[model samples]
Target: MTRIFSLTCLYILFLLSSCSIINWEVEPDNLKITYQDEELSEIFHDHILRFIDEAEKRDMTFRSGKVNIKWGPELANHVNATTFSNGIIKVNPSSVKINHDHLSLQLISHELYHLLCQPPSAYDHRSRHLISGTPYVSSLMVASSKKGEFPTIDNVEMWEYYFDELFLHHGDYSFVYDYESNSK
Candidate 1:
């Protein structure tokens, strides 16, 4: 009788451990991310957390849904990233340079902007017009460089400007010509 009881207790403990392991494996976080390369995973994850923190600082709240991100195939027009309405973001790995932290943050934050902002159109640049000065595009949503490049920010001030433009500004003042001139 003692032997049987001891074996039964061990079996029960094993079953409990197994159940917890399964739960941990299947549980989904707010952001369900998949990366093509394991080395990029941690870097991207840290950037994402920073993005969320910045958004919250601007009083922006994300809707309740698990955003799924994955490394996707080469995007059309050499874009670095694309976000879908259904909370999916695909990053083009080829466009990302592993050692460029600023560029990587920009790419991830740009896509997160799309996912969280849900602008009227996927291509909305949220351009702000000047009443009397030269019109310019300053938002992060503005099209990227046509040569598969993004403008490098030389200082923290420029980075802050882009972040503010993305989170605080609204309305599109882009002319038809602006659309053709900008590339993403």
Candidate 2:
């Protein structure tokens, strides 16, 4: 029993220490938006703002800083509508203009969540964009627990993203709360 307890304590200590390395802390209010093509700027900005409002309603504070939004010819030909903590969200304008049944919003919203709260590792992030987002989603719970993330922002965001991602998958738009209900 003593040996097992000692081993458990050591493992816990190691887990706690490792968590600090993978976390990329960025304030939610520091997010910024800049447009490569001035024309599509407003459109993308509106979408981003909509996401922010939705997140806030859920008590998530993803920042509102100056994020560089690249689209149109300025957008990379082979980019996957990426979002980074560096305040940049790049998307193909063609995809936005012809969203093909509102798929673009789904894609952008997913990336927005990624930017708002990053995955634990670069590899995990890459894997998330693949055809199978489920595997990665399941991994979030285990990975976060392994890292021993306590009551931190990263931990909270991880939970929020986990549930939100699931909600996104089922085409549910009931996340927004009724403000008037609070008055009652």
Candidate 3:
């Protein structure tokens, strides 16, 4: 009886997972507009501008930064944003599905970091040398522990950490933040 019950439970879980509505496909140079919502686009644009402003103030090289954003359902099993090589960032628009402005600036900011540091050409071998301080494993751990809430602490740390690292790569990193405390 116990074995039978366990199998039944497993089947139920599978059914639930299959029924989930979120799905998306990321393609090169193409905007996958999920849910086809116009209002969400405007709201995301405003936040993107704010992110650009902050990025510019920190580093002038990114002053002319522009990114293509495509909205879609929170398709990834993990509720997060991603930047593709084609200079586009994909955002899970579920939070804004109800309240258009409920989006988080941190999401856009984090992905923008990826977009900026991307290699200018496919032939640039140095692109692989750059590191994303927020490792996928750590991000997965924090995501599972919080059950989909934003990692405020990690987000803030990443902002400073990535900036310092980026500056250091260019040499003369006097402007970079001291990472002594990060050791803790």
Candidate 4:
């Protein structure tokens, strides 16, 4: 059974990878590290902890018990970071360009916030009309930062409107949160 399950997982991963809209390549080891100065790392760590604590207060659980952050210079400027269901968040090592010491800690929190408050499924919920009924908890992160504000609550509310229109004819909300969507 274990062998069968492993093979099944591999097959599913292959399918998902092929269907992914974001095409990201793995970074080489030598270029994979972003060495932040002591001060910046400390500051970034504080923010990250705060984000996690806030989520916990709301009874939210991360897809992965631990969030993994990595930095590599090969990433493009447009690419801030991407969060996978498996709990990996990769940031551009050279994101600050000149000031590597000032890592985008809020940006890191923003991405993790997305993971913590993901719509439960990959199916775009942007069309749901639930409005106040469907809230994106991460929106609160916005109030804390000017640069890496989490997705606006208004944006999420609009997403609810669109989701309902597309998925359900009525305003009834029906669906299961899919945490296994990216399970390996």
Best by lDDT: 1
Best model number under TM-score: 1
Candidate 1 on 20-56: residue-level lDDT in tens?
Answer: 6632222223445555566557657777776776776
| Clash counts for all predictions | 0, 10, 0, 13
Task: State TM-scores per candidate.
Answer: 0.59, 0.45, 0.41, 0.41
lDDT of 4 by residue, 1-184 (tens): 9999999999999999886743232211111212245543553565565455444444444433445565645667766566667656666655552242122434654565555445436412223221232333222223222332223324444333323322232122332122112211
Residue-level lDDT tens digits of model 2 in 46-135:
655656655555555543345576653465654446566676677766553323322333455556666655442431332222112222
Off by over 4 Å in 3: 1-37, 63-66, 95-103, 120-184
Q: Candidate 2 regions off by >4 Å? A: 1-30, 72-80, 96-101, 119-163, 166-184
- Give the per-residue lDDT of model 3 (tens digit) for 1-184: 9999999999999988985632222222222223235764665655555554544555534311346777646567465555676656666756442242322544554455456543434212112221224322122111122222333434656544544443334322332223433443
Predicted structure 1, TM vs. truth: 0.59
Which 10-residue window in model 4 sums to the lowest lDDT? 26-35
Give each prediction's root-mean-square deviation over alpha carbons: 11.9, 14.1, 16.1, 13.8
lDDT (Cα, 0-100) at 68 in candidate 3: 70
